[model samples]
Target: MRPVDFEYTSPTSIEEVVRSLADGGGEATIMGGGQSLMPVLRMRMADPDLLVDLRRVPELKQVREEGDHLVIGAMTTHHTVAHDPLVAAHAGVLGQAAASVGDPQIRYRGTIGGSLAHADPAGDIAPAVLALDGAIEISGPAGARTVPAAEFFHGPFTTALDEGEVVTAVRVPKHTGWGMHYEKFAQVAQSWCIVAVAAAVQVEDGAVARARLGMANMGQTPLRAEAAEAALRGAPLQQGALHDAAARAGEGTSPAVDAAGTAEYRRHLAGVLAGRAVTAAAGVGG
Candidate 1:
């Protein structure tokens, strides 16, 4: 079904968007690349009275580095994120995840900020951002604020974004020289992840100095494998130690039961993929 009739405005400035949203009084929806929202609209899943498009806002389409963080604009497309040299250099895991977001068409139109705001548990970007210790920038009538990726996701399809607030950018700390990989398991190509792992490893003298692991489709939200990350610290760069650390990936988590697989099966895949992700990221022989 087609979306219901709605007022639409393509604002060129954030202030105009914010003011329009305020006037909408909780009946407005921000449109980024619209790759995700259009489907929702057509299905009648959501029907906002006003649609505020951000495409005309040049400020929201940039990719730049500030101090020690890489700030990616909210409207930046997945295709750009996947191929941008700066993203590849500073946040390889995020870039890798962007590359795996969908087929070429979806990647060309989907935006990272839109994906994070949609907050799909199986989405590739959120877990990668969480593993990178990134932050989400927000703007609204109340002014702007930043929320860390860990605190940004509240539940599946839910986030810390208040009504009328738009995600302006995503700030990720630079991780130069770090080994990174995004491991995903899907029923078919371009399908959502059944279970996926985002691994970033820092090695020092043949030992794991630091490790960050985030798993998708294993809980209410994308979750960090704290147990596994803790165990990997100071562990030798060997398959045995890596497997031991990876085995803890499923600890203290409850995944959902769905057509994709059972919760138990998802948990099992988490552990197995954790091992593969960490091994490849840390440069250990598979």
Candidate 2:
């Protein structure tokens, strides 16, 4: 099934892309690396009348630091992030997650903004971003606005992006003293994760100072296990506390049944992987 007829526009500027999308309104879709959107179009899952290509927009291709956050342009490819020393030093969680997205070819072409905008619950970056409390910056006719990572994802393949808006960049908080771990359960390297966990923990004197845990493929969106987080707060970073917290990892989760894993299996995995992630972040796991 080929895509329906559509008008293509390669906007050289972010402003041009925003205006084109505004002009076409709901009939338009932004194209980044086309790793996800192309498949959506080919299968007729999405049939936008206009394709606003963002390849020419230089604003969407930067990686820099601002204040306490690392600002990454929406068009920066996964390959770049996975290999960049700056990203590794500042946000190793994202770098680790980016290296696991799809395969080498996909990583080379797939953009972080595209993956976040696509909003697949199984996608790697969403959970990592959620764990990091990242922020997304968007541009539209109304001007620019920043959205918290928790509010960015609304549901499966759904986001807070309104019509005519484009994600310009993502701001990941600087991981100065946090220990990070990204643990994924997949049958193969390129397969989607059945259950994955991204954990960021700040430990001091063998106690958990702060913990943010994000689990993927556990619900409608990348879900942060509030129960698990609550359990870990101010607790001793020991095996007993980690196991106790892991039990609550899937407390409020209702994962979808798919070929990858049953809901029950995924729920069980949430517990297992959450333990692994937290343990790893606490520097207790290999």
Candidate 3:
């Protein structure tokens, strides 16, 4: 399949990108690494009049530490994030999840901003970002503003980004000493996860002080397992305690029945994977 003819422009500045989007009258699509959009375009899922490319924007490719957060530029590649020392030290969950995205080629070509903006429920990175309580910075004709990661996704393949708006960076709180793990179940290597859980635990004096749980492919959007998280808090850092908390993993989720598995199967996987992820993070078991 071939995409329809469209005008393309590679802009070095955000202002120019916004101007191009504005000129296209809401019919423009922004291209970061193009790992996701290229497939969508070739399949004719979207037909935009203009394509605003951000690959030339130097400012969007930087990863820096600001205050208490590690700020990752929107155009930063997954490969860079996976191997970056700053990211590994500050946000290990993100680095672990980024390292598991697709394959080496996809990781080299895919961008964090692109993955979050695409808002796929099965994407590995978004779940880890959600568990880390990340935020996204958006720039548009109106100005710049921030959106929390929890509120960024609207539905599968949809987000809160409006016309003329571009994601400039993602800000994640540094979990310097916390234990983190991303557990995924896929049919084959390099395949999308059928069910995955991202867990970050802060253990204190042999007790779980704080726990964050994010589920992938559990609903229309990546969701936080609030019930499970609440149950884990103050619990002992043991396998039995973690298993009990993970039992409620699918309490509020709405998984879909698909070729990967049935809804019931996914719900079961959620609890099983949550136990594994949380236990691994807490160092309760291998």
Candidate 4:
């Protein structure tokens, strides 16, 4: 399917991109890797007057360490994030999640910024980012600002971005020695996750000191399993403790029923996956 006629502009600088979006008002769409936007365009889901391309902005394609966080440029591809040694060392859960997105070709073209901006409830990266408590950097006509991952997604296919704002980078605090895992359940190898869990656990003296759990496709937005986290704090790293914590995984979730499964089924998967993910991160067996 061919998309409607639209003006396209590739800007070399973040400032230029902001100006282009501001000029187009709300009739402009920002194009990152085009992995998600192209499909939307082909389906006529979005008919913007202009397409502001960010490919020419080199600064948006870098990965570096800054202070306590590892900053990843929005244009960094999933393949790069999945393979970069720096990312693997600092945020292994993010790398594992990126490796699970789509197939090889999709990972080669999909951008981290693009996935976060698209805010798909089933996207693999969102849950990992949410679990890591990452932050998103944005640039716009007004200026630059940061939004925490928890506050970034408003709902499925929705975000906190305002008109003329483009995501420039993502910042995640270094978790050099933490145990992390991304657990996903899908119908096929490259299909969207029916339910996914991202877990990061910090152990102390054979006990679960801190745990972060993020759920994918469990709600309108990627959600943190706060109740599960509370239940696991200071608990022994054992099968019983993991199951007890995971039982509360669906406490505050509102999952949707679709062709993949019913709401009840997803809620059940949430608990089961959470237990597996947490135990795996903690290096405990059931």
Show model 1 residue runs off by greater than 4 Å: none
Worst 10 residues of 2 by lDDT: 239-248
TM-score comparison, 2 vs 3, better candidate: 3
The lDDT for every candidate, in the order shown, is: 0.93, 0.89, 0.92, 0.93
Q: Candidate 2's residue-wise lDDT over 1-286, tens digit each?
A: 9999999999999889989998887899899999998888999998888999999999899999899889999999999999888788878888889999998999999999999999999999988888888999999989999999999999998999987899999998998778888999998879898889988988998888888888888999999988888888888878878867866888878999977878888888888888888888888754
| Angstrom error at residue 136, model 1 | 0.3
User: How far in Å is the alpha carbon of 60 misplaced in model 3?
Assistant: 0.8
Q: What would the TM-scores of all predictions be?
A: 0.98, 0.95, 0.98, 0.97
- Which candidate number would show the highest TM-score if scored against the true structure? 1
Per-residue CA lDDT of model 4 for 1-286, tens digit only, reads: 8899999999999999999998898899999989999988999999999999999999999999998899999999999999999988889999999999999999998999999999999999999998998999999978999999999999989999998899999999998888998999999989999999999999999889899989999999999999999999998988887878877887778899899999889988998899988898899975
Q: What are the runs in model 2 whose C-alpha is more than 4 Å off?
A: none
Q: lDDT per residue, candidate 3, 1-286, as tens digits? A: 9999999999988889889989999999999999999999999999999999999999999999999999999999999999999988878889889999999999999999999999999999899999999999999989999999999999999899998899999999999899999899999999999998999999999999999988999999999999999999999977998888987888878999988999889988999999998998898975
Give the better candidate number (1 or 4) by TM-score.
1
Error of 4 at 84 (Å): 1.1
lDDT measured at residue 147 in model 3 versus the true structure, 0 to 100? 98
Compute the lDDT of residue 141 as modeled in candidate 4. Answer: 79
Model 3 TM-score relative to the real fold: 0.98
